[model samples]
Target: MSLNSLRERLIERLTPAGAWTPDGLPDRSDYDLNPDAPRSPRTLRPAAVLVPVIARPEGASVLLTRRSDTLASHTGQIAFPGGRLDPGETAVQAALREAREEVALDPASVEVLGVGDGYETVTGFLVTPVIGWLAEPPVVSPSPDEVAEVFEAPWDFLMDPANHRRDFLEPESGPRRWFWAMPWRERYIWGATASILRALHARLYGDEARPGAAVGEDAA
Candidate 1:
């Protein structure tokens, strides 16, 4: 689908309350924050991330960040621009604010299409993925303390179902862990970020392709 068409469909799917978390998407319902779970959280919060799409001269790409190692959680990980939701702030507002703070992305330049279902992380966060279309590319500069490097991956690469992989890790007799993988360039996209992307891909393109192996090489 064209960028415009995709944006419209996402908006239609997300505008209604609880639309994103409709009875589809198995993972949406299975998430639990029980401390007994292997990856139980010390604390959990509601958060949002902006899945910012830019119409680059090369093609359409989604902006991402390699987080600094100093962060307490998910350090050195590839992540979307987002964080915990503040008091009185809506999920969309938190996403835009976090994007601007992390990457200098101007909120005014983005047109929010809609939000995907909330992806609950083992780290104790209910993360809402906000899909947005950038009307024009803005100057992007990573915040040194919070972001190590800012990069963009082709939207087509992420949306393609053939690139989605499901991996399991047995954590010391704990629950069998499941996560999605999407390899692009030198980066191995996985974990909660990849899971959400996988859901979006499945929503946009039905699950016809078989799961593959993790993108083994480090894209760094």
Candidate 2:
């Protein structure tokens, strides 16, 4: 799809930027896959992530990053550029700020399209996925303290339902943990990052495009 069409579709389908509430629970969440899991915390810390879609001649690509291995949590995981919202900051502001801090993504270069469904993470964060359109590919410099590497995953590969993998792990305690996974080349994309991508796919296409869990064995 062309950038114009994609932007129009996103604006039409995504939640309006004005509709996002700091604590309002969106229809989508991590619990979507783990329906039988325990309830989420009553007070969810609000966080925002930028879903940067860069315009490429072949097609659009999504910008992603590998978190620094030195981080206290989720180290080396493939993720979008984002973090907890600062005091009085809106989702858009927070997303842009986090992107700038993590990958040197210029806020001025991104045209904020709209926001997707709010995702409540298993770790007690209410994440708002802010979609941004980049007219051209960006020159991103990853911060050594926070990001190990910055890369682009083809938008087509990410949006294709066939590439969405149902993966899970049986924890020592509690029920098995299930989450979305999309393995690209040498990177393993899963957890909240993959879940957000899956949610976006469902929104753009339809729930009919969502696949059933792979049976008999782990698919991660």
Candidate 3:
């Protein structure tokens, strides 16, 4: 689909975001965040991330970030620029703000499309994926304290079911965890980030393609 078409479709699927919706691309009912399944999830902390799709002439690409290794959580992992919602802030507000802070992504330069379903993470975060379209690539500088690197993944590659892989990991704290993993070149994308992307893929392609993997969260 063209960039404009994609934008319009997203707005139709996810406008008036933040609230859980069963009518759109990101259907969340399939995900079961097992509370008694272990880990340290006490509550679902509200978080948001900007899924930036850059409109290139050839096609589109999704912007991704590698978190700084020094950070306490999810260090050195690939992720969309986003974080916990500040008080009184909506998901869109937090997504835009976090994007700006982490990658110098100008909110004025982006066209907000809509948001996907809210994903419940094992780390106690309820993350809303905000979709935004960039007509062209923007000047991006990673924050020294937050982002270690910035890159893009081809939209076509990401939305292909052939690349998606289901993997199992036995965490020390619980039973074997069956999660998705999408490896791109030297980078490994897995866990909650992959799950969220898979959800979006399922919504957009209707089971035709699946999210192969993603960069975010930890194995534990």
Cand. 1 TM to true fold: 0.79
In model 2, residue pairs whose N, Cα or C atoms come closer than 3 Å (at least 3 residues apart or on different chains), thus clashing, are: none
- Evaluated with lDDT, which candidate comes out highest? 2
Indicate the worst ten consecutive residues by lDDT in candidate 3: 211-220
Q: Candidate 3 lDDT, tens digit per residue, 16-100?
A: 5646332223235224533246555255678889999888776678899999999999899889999998988888889999999
Poorly placed runs, candidate 1 (over 4 Å): 16-44, 170-176, 207-220
Candidate 2 accuracy as TM-score: 0.90
Stretch of 10 with least lDDT, candidate 2:
211-220
Report the Cα lDDT for residue 208, model 2: 39
Write down the TM-score of every candidate: 0.79, 0.90, 0.83
lDDT value for model 3: 0.74
Model 2, 1-220: lDDT tens digits are 3566667767888888877778677667778889999894578899999999987766778999999999999999999999999999999999999999999999999988889878888888989999998988899999999999999988768887788999998999999988899999999999999989988877876743333221101111
Candidate 1 lDDT, 1-220, residue by residue in tens: 3555555556665544335432223245124323345553244578889998786655677899999999987888899999988887787889999999999998989988777767777666778888888867778989999999999887778876678777667879667766777988799888888878877765654533431211111011
Worst 10 residues of 1 by lDDT: 211-220
